[model samples]
Target: MYKNINIFTDGSCISNPGPGGYAAILQYYQYEKIFSQGFFYTTNNRMELMAAIIALESLKENCNIIITTDSKYLKEGITKWIINWQHSKWLCSNKKPVKNIDLWKRLNITLTNHNIHWIWVKGHTGHIYNEKCDKLARYAATNPTYNDIGYI
Candidate 1:
């Protein structure tokens, strides 16, 4: 039988391109693991993508994973839009390059190793794990300790 893993992720930014952070909660059975980090300067969308990437990368082996996020952008991009984007060599409908291509590429790679089901949850809608992740991301955004290498 395959293992089932539940993951909740969230991201926050102080401003549109200000201090930002991402958080992930991985739950397997009764044990839970958390991952979170902050960047000195970044956008909320980048953080949202990072949260999913970090959570998937943390898995040591292939498993059935249900990743829950509050970002529709994150969910739709990975589950749907990436296909078209990849077919176009990472170009958008406007024939422009996609933003956060680096993170998207990384997440795409990490996904190959597992069975992932993406889920979107409404933010601040009384979801316990989602709320915790939101808090973690907000706290990290307010107190970043690292530079966002991907930020230009």
Candidate 2:
């Protein structure tokens, strides 16, 4: 039997290259774990990716996970687009180096440790956990600055 985990993640940014934040909610059995972080300088995409990465990295052992995100870039990029990027040495179709290669690499490594099913949900809706994640992310983004992780 496999232990199933449900996760919801969100990201927020005041400006494209300004303060940003990410949040992740993990639900397993009857327990829930919440993770949120703020970045002094970051983008929504990076935060979105960070949300998922943080959730996966928090795990101590292999499990089956359902990861939900509001960003299609987060879902489709990891599941659909990354294969080609990996084959092309992290290059996009135009052969430009893929952005956020570091985070993507970290995510890829974390992914190898578990079985993940990606799902995309509409943002700003009334979904309980999704809304909670969004609130946490927005709060982190608008709040005080934190140590920058130097996302590229």
Candidate 3:
């Protein structure tokens, strides 16, 4: 039997607002691949969002994807409570503006074109793909020489 496509993504930054990177890995039975990008100046949240977006974008149109990430932001925003925010024009509970609205909007649009299942996994528990994603993200953060791939 053919298994479902599985993807895991992660992002890391040296500081809350510092050099950052995002990584994503996709697997389907016998096939697997990884994608990652880094930025010289960014936040962990941005990278996290980027990782998910990148992973989803890598899939063929309309293909169902089961995406796993450690980010409550991605899981909750996409699965739990994004509609309310969208209806409210991207404002938060305090009526304050949401951060990274651009990326959020892009991710939302990308998701609409594909069947995606957002999943949450505990971080740093020795899960092979999860750990690999973390390593890829950290490596990109540490290596600032890499060019930035902004908001794609």
Best prediction by TM-score: 1
What's the lDDT of the predicted structure labeled candidate 1? 0.92
TM-score of each: 0.97, 0.95, 0.90
Each model's Cα RMSD: 1.0, 1.1, 2.6
User: Which ten contiguous residues of candidate 1 have the minimum total lDDT?
Assistant: 143-152
Query: How big is the positional error of residue 130 in model 3, measured in Å on the Cα after superposition?
Result: 0.7
Error of 1 at 21 (Å): 0.5
lDDT of 2 by residue, 5-71 (tens): 9999999998877889999999999999999988888999999999999999999888999999999
Model 2 CA deviation exceeding 4 Å by range = none
lDDT of 3 by residue, 1-152 (tens): 22467889999998878888999998888898888887888889988998988887777646678898998988888786678889889998899877888888888988775667778889999888889999999998887665654543
Among residues 3 or more apart in sequence or in different chains, the pairs in candidate 2 whose N, CA or C atoms overlap within 3 Å are none
The TM-score of predicted model 1 comes to: 0.97
Candidate 3 local Cα displacement, residue 111, angstroms: 0.9
* After superposition, candidate 1 runs with Cα above 4 Å error: none
Evaluate residue 128 in candidate 3 and report its C-alpha lDDT on the 0 to 100 scale.
Answer: 83
**Which stretch of 10 consecutive residues in model 2 shows the poorest summed lDDT?**
143-152
